[model samples]
Target: MGLFALLNRLFHHGPAWLTFLVMGLAAAGLALCSFNLLFLFQANYHLLFTYGAMAAFDGGLLQFIELTAWGYLAIACYVVAEGCLEGLLTRIRRAQL
Candidate 1:
């Protein structure tokens, strides 16, 4: 029963392949950029490494806090827009009926 319930829950969440695909593409792009910065652009490697280390050690929390605020704002805006669209569609359907 638990297994069936879990499967049912998963099935209801919609497909995940597209999300995974996009995430994979983004990871690949980031890897490529890092590879290029570290290898292809050898002249700037030391500067990049220093900055990266600084961000990794010193600015980690600061970066997360700053980026998280922007992320939250973007998500909130998306949710509001989605709700508005859904409400508008619902009203249109009711009017048609």
Candidate 2:
């Protein structure tokens, strides 16, 4: 009985820890992406202010597109993190049953 209880606790906590780790990583990724996106926009805006609109637009267009892709990637990471939590919750609920 003691051994089974110990094993059960280990198994239960292991997945919880794993879920937290994954969520933390995903949050970090999202923060990095958001910071980069803001930095890029600030730099582009500076360029536009220093240079003319036409010159800035010529170079900044590519940056805008790249940021859009990164934004999507950040969203994907968020979704994955949410899904992981949801899956973990479902498992816990089924175990309780």
Q: Which stretches of candidate 1 lie over 4 Å from their true place?
A: 1-60
The sequence of per-residue lDDT tens digits that candidate 1 reaches over residues 1-97 is 9955643333333244533343345445444434433343343344446678664566554554554555555454444334334444455676799
Q: Candidate 1: RMSD over Cα atoms?
A: 14.0
Best by TM-score: 2
- The TM-score, computed over Cα atoms with residue i paired to residue i, of candidate 2 is 0.60
Candidate 2 global lDDT: 0.71
After TM-score superposition, the amount by which residue 46's alpha carbon in candidate 1 deviates from its true location, in angstroms, is: 13
Candidate lDDT values, in order? 0.47, 0.71
Please give, for residues 4-67, the per-residue lDDT of candidate 2 as tens digits: 5654443345567776677678878888777768777778667767777685568766766787
lDDT (Cα, 0-100) at 59 in candidate 2: 74
Candidate 1, poorest ten consecutive residues by summed lDDT: 7-16
TM-score of 1: 0.41
